[model samples]
Target chain A: MKLVNSTLAALRAVRVNKLRSALTMLGIVLGVSSVTVMMAVGGGASQRIQTEMRNLGANTIVLNSGALKSAGVSKGQGSRPSVTLADAQAIENEVPAVTATSPQHNFAGMQLIYGNANWSTLVTGTTPEYLTIRNWAVSRGRAFDREDVIQGSKVVVLGRTVAEQLFGNQSPVGQEIRVNRVPMTVIGELAAKGQSLAGVDTDDTAVIPISTALNRVVGRNPANPRAISGVIIKVRDGANMASAFSDIRQVVRERHGLLPAQEDDFHLINLTEVMRAKEDSARALGILLAAIASVSLLVGGIGIMNIMLVSVTERIREIGLRLAVGARRSDILGQFLVEATILSLIGGIAGVVLGLGGAVAVERYADLGVVLNGQLSLVAMAFAAGVGIFFGFYPAWKASLLQPVEALRSD
Target chain B: MALVAVSDLTKTYMLGQTAVPALRGISLAIDRGEFVAVMGSSGSGKSTLMNLLGCLDAPSSGTYHLAGQDVLRLSSNKLAAVRNTSVGFVFQQFNLLARATALENVELPMVYAGIGWRERTRRAREVLAQVGLSDREHHRPSQLSGGQQQRVAIARALVNQPLLLLADEPTGALDSVTSDEIMATLVRLNEGGLTVIVVTHDAEVARYARRVIHFKDGRVVSDDLNQNIRAAA
Candidate 1:
């Protein structure tokens, strides 16, 4: 009952000064709204990164052939194809944490032909484990098997984009297509994978057996006939990835017969680590935005304090009368504190409404994704109320400390 | 036994580094149901005495017993409770919250006393009827006449059923006619067995009291029964 009375009295006081109250609340409104927007934008960016990481495949690492140095001159990655199919097999057999490995040799700008439709795209020569390491699914027919690799079959699996261009609406499975003027049979068509984090079309390339590419299409490198491009390693779930990464590096280094002083001839890329770094930066940006927004909220709290001080001064006689009539010191303090809290709480609610609207507008017109977090909105409101209490205390204390006799004597 | 008893009540306020005595070694007693008037010019310390008696302020050196409780020795919170339940005060300014309705003003004391809303409203309305402002319960102070506002304040003072009603210059701001009307209400309430004390400088206002005490320089000069009591006429 006491709380109800204080609240009612506070609401009446607010009603008495409508315009002033609204202006004071405007600060809190802007503060909370901006906080809401920043949190939502941050959430959206984090979610987008999560989706990109899923598409890139989880718990996987890329082992790229590093620079090959000779005569004090260096050729860039994959130049001399130092990575071989035997190195991939050795890593899979040597590292217990490594579950699967897919060795690949990529030939870009290969012309794919079906009937009169000819489209230029990258052709990847990889083993069957590539499908598992890359999380790629075949939407039609079947994938090339170990038998196809061992026999060096002239068969290919078309990516969605290549399939669309070469076959249009018709299923390309069981059909024959030509890669770089070499005839190959279409064994399967891959499911569509959307754009990568770099905005490259992931479904715009074809896959073939690495043995077929080395023997028939691209031909072998004269220096190392068994040379392959690079290897994709999938680590077992729940195993320590860092340890697995170092273990693979050791295996590769030992196989290359390199000395301890020699620079590593291979480089490792942890896909999740790269994505997490981006996530951390996005989170940092969000914190910075929220910090900036809270400065406005601080200003709003100061405004509440200023108005409450003025109110206390203006109501001296009323305070005296209350004190005279037997109100406890806590009663007077509670009255003003409640008034301030009500003001900011209303402002916080208004801000939530405005901010949600702003988030929708950003999503629509600004082309940004937003995920509204219920917990975050609640925290914003709690913070607003806290701000009110912190700033309202001094003025309320002053009012409560007034002596009844002196207060009653005041005009 | 006296309802209010005080001995050697002295209040000294600090003015810079010097002490200014508002009350100097005053002793007084008033029995229950007595209608007494304290007469004094400005700065004579009658107001300070009333504040001490009403438990609004503690005396610097004094022993005060309201009923049986030691008013001077109680904590500030207890003092507020005594003021709420034992002494009702009315100021010359009416002191009604300008924004509150007459009913709400009367309910203020009960609100502090932690009464339920239904009982507080019922009792407030009863006292408003007693003060002849029952029909104006919904009117704010700004909407009411001065006399009507004072009646609302009186209703507020009466709502808590205090042991004593202390009115400091209750008619100081009213015209002669409204003054007599207010005095008549006090006279009728006193006849009903309520203890009433009015502090004022006006002789006409004192004429309604059964006993009158005069003060000069923070000391009482005379205490006598009124031979020509006005009888609220």
Candidate 2:
């Protein structure tokens, strides 16, 4: 039989039970739509995280002093010795692979006073290299220079949030603000940095040179004078990060006088490793969503098969009439297969539209980065059509194999 | 030469391992352009024999030649081809597709024969006109009267111009007046050189045929020329 004729006949058959056909196709629509929407949302979240990670400086590495409780009782159970200015200088001088190094000393709940106005904020003390390692660019004013650090000048750089809170629209550059009863001149304002996924406010802190912060503002404790919170390092190139990390570890152990068998009291956090972990978690989440959506597709396929079987049973007499008119088994098969495929194709088209609409709405209204990728939509559509073919075959085959005489005899 | 030759044709059913014979060694020959009727009471195997001759079922054991081709030797595809091009069937229930118009129902066989839509439609209209259904071509089976539906079935059967027309109790569901109308249509086609076979228990319906074959207990008890009946008709 001509394919066009058979397809028309199949269409006529489906049209006879319009409500039933639509109900059957509803399952496929839901299945494909859910798959598309979930993929969009999941893919969007991973892309957002990657963008944040890139903005945080791809080559940056964080080093923190590990607690000495597990090392031995003689070392005392207090916070481990901080990474110092000398240690930062040693890494910069001895490690050729190290591009820049900065020691960070953070003080929380610090009150900043500017004449009659005072606001509480976080205070961070570091060298000029801190801006490069952290990927922060000065937005409004110039950053503090090495001259300010050497002279132990009481100078500071305000983050966007701190500047806005204290000075409003007025420029705070070269203006003096007091910190813990010590006055300091603001030399720059950091750029506007958004909050991280971990909910940390990046633009609510103040940056000051480490020398002035330790000696002039927050005086170093007599028991731990040379103490610093942690060290931030930037590598010349990522290709040599592993080698540079081992060299830095050796130098730190030697300077601290730790034996070969002793466990190092410092922890290194490679940003590259953190980025990879985030990517792996995102990938796992995507797979889980895909798997759950696939269950809906499976259920939809089964629904199609079930409805097709009922259709076959209901149309036995019609099948008999066609067979009597000289229809081959393949002709019957083609007719039913065409009906099934049309149902799935219609459902797939509807799903694509609905899924894209859903993604766009969520992205706009909920502030998510959801986006419908074209390739994924195509794959989902193809999979839905394949499901129709796979599940539609058995019922169609059963209809084709029916004996004409017996079918005609059926009431 | 005979258009249909059947010898020692037997068919049996196995109902849970009990062999029940429907037909036992039935031999018959039908010449081209002949109008023959097979008459029997219920359970007399007349319908079984009709089903075999119509190519709707295969005999358990038999050598049946249709148009000089060994019907038993044909493959399923060949058999389907033979059924498509060589045989037309009319059933008691009219068997017209309920969803199709009268013209579309008649065009169905040509669709199976791989005819193009234009030619199928043309031939279907011509046949519908021949059966006096030209004005009702657009009507579905449910919209037509019993007699009209039967005529549509006859038009469908004749669309392929088959070598034989097999009618099984074709008028069983119609009233006497409608039955007469349907029989007259069949008689006119048979007179126009189409071989016709009618299987029925109605003696009055059998009178229209040129010959009569009677069956009892799965075997033919009498086969005779109906000269008186034919002369009267």
Candidate 3:
């Protein structure tokens, strides 16, 4: 009965000081909402990384040409001609862990024209195995065949973005689109791959046979006509990525005839390792954001304590009157404690609402994915109540220690 | 047997490093159904003695028995319970909760007594009606006159059906007409077998009581029955 009365009394007191209560609750509201938003953003980022990694294909690695020194200055990766179509074939045949390989030569800034409409896009030339190496599916028609590559056929596979840019809603398959003034027949359209980790569009390019690109389009290089910029390799399932990486490196080095003391002209990128590092950083960022937000909750608790102390001093006569009417010291303590808890709990409930709204706002306006669950909200509420009790203790204790005679005597 | 019995009661106050005696060795007894008024000046120790008798403050060295229970020997919590069920205090300020309704103010003691809501409301209404404030039950203390607020405080004091009603200058804040009205109410309640003790320096207020005790320098100088009780008026 005492608890019930005290709670009611607390609620009444809060209602009486409307502006002060609302201002006090604002701190907690902001803290909880920010915490919720940070956790959601972190969860969303990690999830996106996982999907991007999946799109890159499981147990896949990319081998790009390392720097080449010219006049004592080094050109960056992919700037030198290192790996070739022959090296790709050798790695697949020699390494037991290697499942599929595709040597790629990129022709960027290629203007694609289709009857009055034209768009500038990248054109990647590779063998038929490129589709399999990338786990890319033909959404509209069939992918190019090995016979097409051997015959040096002028056939192309348009990406979802390229197809949409040139054809709008129309199907690009079997249509003729001139690439750099060379008319090529579109064989199929690749499925949309969305954005990459660097925020670049992945579906804004076209794929063609390497023979067609090297022999007819760009002409052959005098040093190594068959040299390619990079090779995409798919390792066998259940094989260790690190071991397969070293084995592929060894095979590439041997095929290139590099001595043991010489530096290799290629670099390997393991998608799994990149994904793990990205996830770790995301988790760390989440903890940092949560830590910063919780400081505001602590500040809010201190604000409540400050107000409760003032209230105790103001209601000295009321406390004395209660004591004279047979209120135990514990009852006085319990009453103030209940008041503080109710303030924070109500703030917490409001914060949960505000936090969910904030998460949605980030997802919509900030263009970041957000993930909010029931468990996070519940934990926030419980923590808010705990903060109330912890900070309200000193003031409630002070109120309880007051002497009835002295308190009643005070004006 | 007396409702209140005190033997050799003494209370001392600490004024920084000095020990000031508020109450010297004093002994008194007031039986049930008696209306007693203790009159004294500002530094006469009448208020300190009243505080001790109401169990609001413990005596420095004394024994106090209220309705056969040793009040000074009880634990703090037990003493609080005794104060709740055995004694009701009415302050000169009419110390009713300003924000609470007259009904709620009357129910405060019963609330502390752990009484259920329905029973508390019932008894609170019963006592408010006794104080002739049934129509003004929902009025807050600020909304009522000084006399009405005092009546509400008295109703609060009587709600737990205490063995003793300790009124410290119950009419000090009221005008002469209102004071008479409040004194008349106390006299009528005393006639109904309630033990009442009013502490005041007003000789006029003291005349309403069946017995008057005068205090000077923490010592009772006189204890005598009133020859002509003002309640007959």
Candidate 4:
């Protein structure tokens, strides 16, 4: 028999029971929709983590001093020994792969005053290289130059949030601000960087050259001339990160005069390691979502199989008449399979639309950066078709195997 | 040569553990262009013989030749081919696919024979017009009268232009007037040089045929040419 004619006949047969056919197709719709939605959400989250990782500077590693333990109690419980400027210089000179290093001292809840308008924010003291290594951009005015850092000039760079809060809609360039009763000039303002995946406000911090911070602002202790908070090291290339980290650790150990086999005082954070951990967690979440979505697909396949069985029973007389008139068993099987495929294809098309709409809605309303992948949609459509064929086969086969005489005898 | 030749045809059924013989060593020959009626009371095995002749069932033991080919030795697929190209069937209940229109119903056999849609439609319309149902081509069987449905069935039987027509109780469900119309249509078809075999208990239906065979106790008791009826015609 001609395939087109057979398909038309199958369509007519399905039309005889429109309600049942629609109900059967509902399973496919739900299955495809669930898979698409899950994939969209998971992919969106993965992209978000990757963007945050990029914002943290791909090659930068952060190192902080560890607490010193003495007599079963940490001596630096609330205040660990600071990583001095000497340590930062040592890492830059001794580690061959270390391209740039900046010693940083951060103080939270610091009050900033710009022309009587004050805002409490995070204050950080670092060199000009800190802006590039932290992926920070100067939107207005100019970042502190090498001359300002060398001359110990009191120039400050305001984060977008601090600038906006202290001087709403007005440029804070050349304005004077007081940090811990020390007057500073705002030479630049950081661009608006929204937020990190860890929910930290990237715009809510202020920057100043470390020399000015050490001499004119937060003066260094007279007793410990090199005292500092911590240091951030940027590797020349991503491939050299591990070796640079080992070299920096060895230098720090030697400078601190640590004994052999003793734990180091400072801790190092490799951005790549954090990225890998985040990727592993994201992958696990994606697999869990996919598994849950598979359950929905399985349920939908079962629904299709059940409806097809009922359809076979309802059309037994027609089947018998077709067989009597010379329809081969394969023809009957093909007819049912075509019906199932049509149902699933329609569902897949609808699911793609729904999934993309959902992604767009989440992006707009929930403030999530979502990317609706075309490849995932294609995979979902193919899977829906496969499910239809897989589950549609047995019932159609059973229908084909029925004895024509017995089927004809059925009312 | 005979269109259908049967020798020592036997058919038995097993009801659980008991054996029942439906046809007992029956032998018959039907020539080309012959309108033969097989007449018997209910349970006389006339239906069973019709089934075997129509290729709807196989005989337990027999040598049957259809169109000079040994049908008894043919495989199922070959038998289906022979049935498709050489034989047409009309059941007592009409056996029309209820959902299909009269034209589509007539086109079914050609569809199974893998004819293209355009050709099947053309041939089905031609045969429906031949049965004087050209105006009712789009009507389903339920929408048509009993006589019309039977005409549609007959049109389907003639659609493939088979060598033989096997009809079982063609007028069993129709009134006397409709039955007469159906019988007249059959007589005209047979007169047009198409071979036809009809199974009926009604002697009135049997009188339309030129030859009649009577069955009793799973065997043919009489086979005779209707010379008087032919003379009257």
What does the lDDT come to for candidate 2? 0.83
In candidate 2, which residue pairs get closer than 3 Å at backbone N, Cα or C atoms, i.e. clash?
A: none
List pairs with backbone clashes in candidate 1.
Answer: none
Sort all candidates by TM-score, best to worst.
3, 2, 4, 1
Candidate 4 lDDT tens digits, A1-411:
357866887687667657876876776677777777777788878887887877778877887877767787876621456578889988889988888888877777888887778998888888888988878789999999778878888889999999999999999998888987789889999988878888788899998888877776666755455777788888886467788778888899999888998887777888778888998898888888779877877786677667666765677777766665667776777777787777678777887787778778877898776767778677867777676666666656765565455466676
lDDT of 3 by residue, A1-411 (tens): 678988987888789768767865766676666667767777677777776777787788888877887897888876567888888888899999999988888878799999989998989888888888677889998888989999999999999999999999999998999998899999999999988767878899999998888877655556566677688998999999999999999998998889999989888898778877876887787777667666766665566556545655667778888999999987887777787788788888888889889889999999887788657766766776666555555655765566688778766
lDDT by residue (B29-61, candidate 2, tens digit) is 999999999999988999889888988888999
In model 1, what is the error at residue A203, expressed in angstroms? 6.4
Q: Label model 3 with its docking quality class.
A: medium
Better of 2 and 3 by TM-score: 3
Question: In terms of TM-score, which candidate is strongest?
Answer: 3
Highest DockQ among the candidates is held by which one? 3
Q: Please give, for residues A168-230, the per-residue lDDT of candidate 2 as tens digits.
A: 989989899998788988989999886665667788889998888888766674556887777
Give one digit per residue, the lDDT tens place, for model 1 in A24-62: 677678777877877788787777777777776788889
DockQ measured for candidate 1 = 0.50
Question: Which candidate do you rate higher for lDDT, 1 or 3?
Answer: 1
Candidate 1, residue B117: how far the Cα is off, in Å: 3.0
Clashing pairs in 4: none
State each model's C-alpha RMSD to the native: 6.0, 5.5, 3.9, 5.3
Q: Measured by C-alpha RMSD in angstroms, how accurate is candidate 4?
A: 5.3
